[model samples]
Target: MDITEFEDLIDRLGEDLSLWPEDRRSSAEELLGHSADARALLESAHALRNALATPPVRAPAGLADRIVAAAKRRADPAEPHAEGETAGN
Candidate 1:
């Protein structure tokens, strides 16, 4: 497989070479062995996978509501400015 296809396969199937299809595994291994760039790509993919698998940090309870309110204010062009703010000021 070309580098783009190889990268896409790892991204779709994840970081485990063993989980790659039987026919593709040998060629992928050879590429990994010979190409520094391919090896780096595999390592980067594994790092991303590990990062995603980490437990998420919890946000403060009201954070979601605050975020939604801010988004709504931004989305609504007619939303009123807070006190003391002028149209062009």
Candidate 2:
């Protein structure tokens, strides 16, 4: 399949593999040609997928408070911006 076709279902790949139901997987195996190049690509994608499943990097000290303070600063500039203000109104 082309990159565009694969992109549509790419994110669901790992989840779908768990529920492949055997028949669909068998068909995929056959269609993929089971060639060396395809096998290599599969291995690379598997490793990349595993890496993506890892937890996000932890923030450094005081980062959370800094973010909250920054958000407040942004909101402060919009003072008196009440519900009825209606933005452009």
Kindly report which residue stretches of model 2 are placed more than 4 angstroms away from their true locations once superposed: 1-12, 15-18, 31-33, 64-89
Residue-wise C-alpha lDDT for candidate 2, range 7-28, written one tens digit per residue: 3333456434445547655554
Worst 10 residues of 1 by lDDT: 80-89
What number of clashing residue pairs does each candidate have, in the order they appear? 0, 0
List TM-score per model, in order.
Answer: 0.63, 0.42
Total clashing pairs in model 1: 0
Candidate 1, 3: how far from true, in Å? 1.5
Q: Which candidate tops TM-score?
A: 1
Top model number, lDDT: 1
